[model samples]
Target chain A: MTAAVEIAGITKRFGEVVAVDNIDLQIDDGEFFAMLGPSGCGKTTTLRMIAGLEFPTEGSLKIFGNEVGTLPPNKRPVNTVFQNYALFPHMSVRDNVSFGLRMQGTTKSEANRRAGELIELVQLTGLESRKPGQLSGGQQQRVALARALVNKPKVLLLDEPLGALDLKLRQEMQNELKSLQRELGVSFVFVTHDQEEALTMSDRIAVMDKGKLLQVGTAEELYERPLNRFVADFIGQTNLLDATVADDDMIVLGNGTKIKAPNPHSPGTKVAMSLRPEAIEIGRRGDVPADHVATSLNGVVSAMNYLGHSLVYQVKIDWIDLEVRTDPVASEDRLGPGDDVSIWWDRTADWVVPDE
Target chain B: MSGVITPRGASRTLLSINSLLVFLFFYAPIILLIIFSFSDNRNVGVWGGFTLDWYGEFADSQPTRKALWNSIQIAVASTIVSVVLGTLGALALERFTFRGKQVFDALLYLPIIIPDVTMAVMMLLFFAELAGVLGLSKGFATITLSHIAFSISFVSVVVRARIAGMDERLEEAAMDLYASRWQAFRYVTLPLIMPGILGGGLLALTLSLDDVVITQFVAGPGWTTLPVFVFGLIRKGVTPLINAVSVVMLLASMALVALSLFVQRVRTTDSA
Candidate 1:
């Protein structure tokens, strides 16, 4: 199937500053694609260019295999739910939703009937009479979603639509938005600064940094196989260890430990290895496996935090602090800040790459 | 203010005092004019007596009625011309990023900064130059044009502030909904700018209604506006009739203020 939206080598620049570097992405039809990054990472700008709110300084955009770069936003079959929900504060929810249809020259009755269906879809049935200010943040978000969806856009662009909601409401809206996207069977190009939001809703996540596409993959894939240090550090938590490349697939650690990986590094080249905290296990010396499948490192438990079901131990290795998560129920011996401990992990779990 | 209390209590007190001072400053002259308007005394002093005779006389006065009619025409014409130009000028000043903006800002604010006498004289000089070139004379048209030129600058100044704070994303959202530039302006920008449009119109109307210095310079043998007529009346010494007329002007000013406040309150609430 053709992608609903295809951004090819898009580059945006403000004189000397490159806001979005040469980047290419293809979003499948009816798929939830998230462009996740920190602020100023060009996620919102990318979405804007796609929505025709902005024109890319270079390259082209295609909707269903047709170039839409020069097209005005109104001509494009896409809608956007802007941050703060940008609902027409002067108009009630129904009118706000009907505005797009009205602009498209829909008859009054037709527009209102379509808006009524959308209102119910967003679970804001009775709120059609309330102005944007009279509704709660969640309700306003629903109104914005309903308003955008009322036009039956081929793709809906959301620029951090849930950023204004409280934590609990934001989480609820996240699931609600995902389900709504699925129900509508329209591709959604969501821009968000929150990784968890991207991970929760996206079929494929594009992690961006400094206007560059760091990596694009499923949540688990991006987290498990981040291409570089930026992606690894950004997608989730990882402690980078200094290592010397042993071969195309192996690297020797600082404390004389060795690990294997699929990454290509020249022998004796300086490389960085990422080890996830949960992958590392805490145990007594005799419990260690006498095989090359795992690498063990000795450290002292500097601090132990009891996190309901699990305990997080801040373990001090030779020269670095390593976080280790262990089951609190099984760990009968409570370790204090200064307690010595051994940390072990499968050698395959260590992700080795060029130092960057 | 104690450490226990923030500026909240003190600010509220300050706001109340400011409101009281403003109310007194605005209404005290109107109150005096009203009291003197109804007085039957030929010489209004300490309210010698109350009667409707002055009102009857003022109403029957031909020159007074004509002056009133002339003021209305000039004010209405100037307001229409000024507001249209003022709104466009304000939007241009606020929206587009351009060269000479600092210069434009200073130019827009120049009419307000200069003394009324200076503004009146400059306008007279410009009009004299125009008449010399085009073989014309200062008249009702000249007076109306002068009012529009000076008061439009005031209207633009009042509106530009509101326009500056307006959310530009509303226009973007409008376009995203498939609205063309014209549609975006008509639907999104126009409604958002209604308050500022009204503000500019009111400013222009009020300024034109009360203009004295500019009108005195611009009006020729053919023109006689209310302020000019009032000046001629005052030269003959203040009368119960002048006070009577003044009372009517005072009431009209009050009504204009009430209308403006009503627009402002409604616009502010709508925006909120």
Candidate 2:
């Protein structure tokens, strides 16, 4: 697969503040790639550099294998859907969509004709004469989308495009945007602070922190196998256990339970064993054991929560607290506070990292 | 302007009274000056049964006519120059950040606060030496310079306020739509800022036209602006012709302000 955008060693600075450090990246043709990070982490800046709105201070950006280092934003073959919709306040919906065509010196008739077609595509067919202020926020977003998409550029950049919408509208827009990308088949570089949004929309996600790209991978890879504690914590919830590697495949935790993990480690090395809440099981058993690959500990259910789709139980064993998903609809064996049970898990469920 | 109110009776009467007082305070003298303009009598108090005598006097005299024409010329020239430079300056100030920005803005606004008399004296001295070296006289050149210098601050302030109120993200949005900076300015920034530029230009035009103190110091033998001409007329005695000119000035100002208010309302309704 040929890459459409190759961002090689891109670095941008605002005086002493380094907004984007030297970054090397490539985006495939017609793929939806998301740059995910917290605010001020340089994800938006990186998107700007890629769009040519910002020139990287110390590196190169290539579009379709052409070195576009000194190209102005208008010269770049990318369009952006801004976060706040930024629909031209003075222009009618149709004129707003036709703006890019007009700039390219297309005939007025042709521009209007094309804009009308694009407007329909975005499902804003009748609201043509209305100015941006007349429309609701969601409607404004659609108009913004139509305006940018009308140009049919090589790539489209959306900077948290759904950020201004209510939660329900945002979820609806996320699905629409995903489907739109699929239908258009244009390379898309999206920037968002929302990890869940990135997970839902991205073909690949690049997680950045403090001007550095921490890890870039598929959502599944990043979710199931994060590169570090930061990526692990950022992507999803993980219960980090303080433990020591007793030997290869075995970790003797501080609470006197020895658990087995698949990864090999040196003996006596301190580690943080990451256990996904779904990994642990809550059940009552007369016999309980602790071993390398499979382990069990006797505990009492400290709390029980019905989580719509699943039941969650907080179990206190000896001294340590463990969270487990229990049977949600078990009438006879409903776990509650002070109910004794054994919490167990398969070794495959946890990822162990050297904490110290 | 409304006379009726729903359970509010004396409040509206008070409002009308306040409005009338404000109008009377500002415009009564201008109306008097206009009435006096038609008086044929040398004494402005007694309107000698309505005559076009002062208008005739004002128009027939070559020097007075030339001075008025010269003022118009200066206002047009100064307005065009100040507007272009001031608009661009406002754009640059809004778009970029550099060192001494606060100082720069303060310096721009300084002329408005400084005493005009001091500026005239200082500029006169500066121009006198420069003119001597250049072997040229200060009249059109000096007055034009003063008007432009003073008008730039007004123009810049208005344009800056207009630009600052604009949503900055709109430019980024334009860029996202593959628009060049120039295109964005042409389609977006220029249209939005046109009102401020026009408004500022009108203010500068009015200022340049009516100025007396600065024009007195700067006028050469060949160049006598309308204000200077009017001042000379006043020195002779308070003629009704001066009143005539004053009324015309007042009318022009009213027209300009009305246009601005109308434009502002339309813009609000059209956009919002």
Candidate 3:
């Protein structure tokens, strides 16, 4: 399928600050794509540029198959649901939904009829005559969504649409949005600072930081095989340790502990290893299962937290804080602070992340 | 705790007394004027039996009628001009950034702060200086122009505040929904700022109708406004006719202020 939105070498500069550095990205047709980043990481800026609200300083942007670099927002074949759900205060829900049609010179009756259908589609039928302020936050968000979707643009851009909702409501809306995009079969480019929301909804995710695209892949791919230190640390909780390559399948940590890893670097080459906390097993040195213990490090528990279903232990070994999470049921002994313990993980669990 | 009033209770009482005093200070004179306008006797401030003779006399007097018409014409003209200029000024200041913005903002407030007598003198001198070059003379045009000069500032201040409170994202939302630049402003921004525009226009009308000092300096020959004519009447000594006219002017201004407030409330509720 042809790409719905293709951005090539787009760069946006505001005086001296480079808001969006040169970047190339594409959204496949009917794909649910997400741009994930921290605040001020240029994710929102990239979305705005594709929506034609911000002009790119360099490079070209195409929507579907048309070059839309210089086109104004009104001329673009895209609609955006803003982060604040910017509903028109002065218009009724029906009028707000019909606004795009009216602007397109559709007859009043036809516009109203189509808007009525859309309102019902968004499940807002009884409150059509009410203004925006008369509705709750969720209702207002639904109206914003209905208003944008009524135009039936080829692509829909959402800038943190669920950011304002509570956790439960956000989860509910995330599912609804995913189903809605699936039903419409239109490309959706969602921008959010939320890692879980992106992972739960997107077909593919783009990790960005400091005006740079770090990596892009499926949720599992990015989590399991992060390309750099930033992506490795950002996707999920992990313990990063400074290390140097020892041999073909081994690396030495700063604390002089040798660990088995698939090191692709030359011997003595400095590297950073990312070990997921959940991947590590914690127990007394000889109590652990022999087959499960690929590499074991003896340590004393500095702190331990009982988290209902699991226990998290912060093991101190030569000034390194190695976090190990173990299911409470699996570990027969109750570990506490100041207790001697051992941490072990499989050889395949430690992945080498790029240092720079 | 048993003997002392709570801070909230004490503040409430103080606020009530202060509000009462303010109401009396502002409404006492207007109430007296309305009551005296209905008095049978011609002597001022002393109430006789109820009568409608002064109103009848006011309706029959040609000079007062002409002066009222002239006041209405000038106030309407100046208010229209002021509304346009003020709305533009508010949009310019609120929607764009440029050099000397702070200086321009300070200048917008200057007309409101300068003494009316000084403004009148300044306007007189300005028109006098331009008379030879532009054939500008003191008449209906001069009075209307001077009223507009001060009214624009009031309008801009009110409208600028309204615009500042508004979210610019509303316009961007409109554009995102396929509205052009003009359509976005016309549908979203204009309706949002309408209350401020109406308020400023009514204030301009009230100020122009109530103006006496500026009118005295700028109004020539028979182009006397109601307030200027009334000031001339007061100098000769207060009359029943003067009280009647003053009551009418008060009612007119009150009606305007009431209308503006009503419109504002309706707009707010509609949006809300």
Candidate 4:
């Protein structure tokens, strides 16, 4: 099957500044894809290009195998839910939802009936006559959603739709949006800066930075194996230690400890090793598991933080510091600051990433 | 308590007296004009018994009635022309950018910033030149054209303010929902800026009605608006009829201004 959207060599420039650099991306049909990045990373711009709100300076954009690079938004088979909801303030909830249908020459009664069903679908019954000004923020969001979804486009582009909501309301809307996409079986190109939101909601995420597509993968793949130093540090918490490749399948840490791991780079090449805090087991010096321990090191516990369900200890090995997270209930030996501890991890838990 | 003389109390009394003087300063002449308009005496200032004779004379005079009709015609025609041109100018300035846009923007404000006498001279010269070439004569058409020339600036200023405060994404959303460019503007942009359009039209009407200097410059024979005719009447003498006409104009202007304020208030409440 053809992809919902196929963007090839897309580049958007505003005068001398490049908003979205040359990048290629594909969103599968019915896939919940997220464009994740920091602010001004061009994720929103890429989404706009697909929605035909902004034409790419140089590229070909196809939706279901049709070239629509320079086509106006009205001619495209896609819709967008803007960040600010952008509901027509003078229009009632029903009228706002039915505006697209009316523009398509639907009869007034027929449009009203369809809009009423959509309003009910968004759980906004009994608000047919109320203007957007009279609705709360969440209600307005639902109206915006219904307005775009009423068109029944092949793909829906959402630009940080939940960024304005409070934390609890945002979480609620995230779950709702995920389920909505699932039930409708439409491709959703969600643009957001929140890593957790992208990881939790998107089936596949494209991480962008500085107008560049850094990585695109499933959540587990991105978490387990980040391609570079930036992706490793951005996706989640990790202790990135500067190391030199000692040989093939081995690397040496700063403190001269050699560890057996898969290394694609030649010897003497500098790299960064990503080790998750939860992957490291901390205990007394002789408590290493014989089968699981690929390497072990002795360190002094500099600080300890109680995180209710888990305990995080800052372990200092020579001049390098590593954070080790431990389950409070599972471990009987409680470690405190100034205690000597040994930390070990399995070989698969550590991966080498490029120093960029 | 009555005997106590606090500094705050003294200042409060002074402030109240100051406010009373200010109110009297503004409304005293208007109040006197209304009272004298009803006087039975021929002299405007004389304290004669109340009568509606001047109002009856104002209504009966054929010249006054003709001038009033002329004023209404000019005001209505000028307002319609100015609202269309001015709204288009405002949309262009606010929504697009091109070469020489700064120059165009600055020139839009020239009519508003220039003195009335200068604008009158400018229009007079313009029509004089046009007449020499195109055989255009100064009459109802010339007067209406001049009124529109000045009133366009005011309408555009008001409309531009409304456009500036609007959220442009609403138009984008309309187009994203399958509305063509013209349809988006007709449905989304026009309804949103309607209050400003109405306000601008009423303001143009008031300006055209109140104009005397420019109309006197461009008006030909028998094309005298009410304000110009009133100014001509003042040169001969101030009569109770003139006072009645002035009061009538004042009431009409106040009503238009009140309607403009009402429309603006509705816009604010709708957005809120």
Best by lDDT: 4
CAPRI level of candidate 1: medium
Docking class of 4: medium
Q: By lDDT, rank the candidates, best first.
A: 4, 3, 1, 2
Show the lowest summed lDDT stretch of 10 residues, model 2 chain B. B4-13
Q: On residues B1-272, what C-alpha lDDT tens digit does candidate 4 reach at each position?
A: 89986557879989889999999999999999999999888887997899998899989999999999999999999999999999999999999998999999999989999999999999999999888786778889899999999999999999999999999999999999899999999999998888889989998999999999999999999889999999999899888889999999999889888878887788777655
lDDT of 3 by residue, A241-316 (tens): 8888898788888888887788788898888898898998887757667775547778898988889888888999
B1-272, model 3: which lDDT tens digit per residue? 68976557878889889999999999998888888999988689888999999998889999999999999999999999999999998998999889998899899889999999999999999998998887867789999999999999999998999999999989898998889999999999999889888888888888888888988998888789999998888888887889899888878877887887888888777777
lDDT of 3: 0.89
lDDT of 4 at B230: 95
The per-residue C-alpha lDDT of model 1 at residue B150 equals 84
Instruction: DockQ winner between 2 and 3, please give it.
Output: 3
Q: What interface RMSD do all candidates show, one decimal each? A: 1.6, 1.6, 0.9, 1.7
Kept native contacts, as fractions per model, are 0.66, 0.66, 0.85, 0.77
Number of the top-ranking candidate, with DockQ as the measure? 3
Query: How well is each residue in A89-184 modelled by candidate 1, as lDDT tens digits?
Result: 777788889999999999999999999999998889887788888998899889999889989899999999989999999999888988888888
Write one digit per residue (lDDT tens) for candidate 4, span A1-356: 99999999999999998998999999999999999999999999999999888999998899999999999999999999999899999888999999988988899999999999889989999998899989988999999999999889899999999998999999999999999999999999999999999999999999999898889999888999899888898898999888999888888888788877787988998899998999999987667788655667789999988899899999998878999998885444788789888898887788898787
Residue-level lDDT of model 2, residues B45-138, one tens digit each, is: 7968889978887778788778878988998898889888888778879988889888887888777988989878877887887886866687
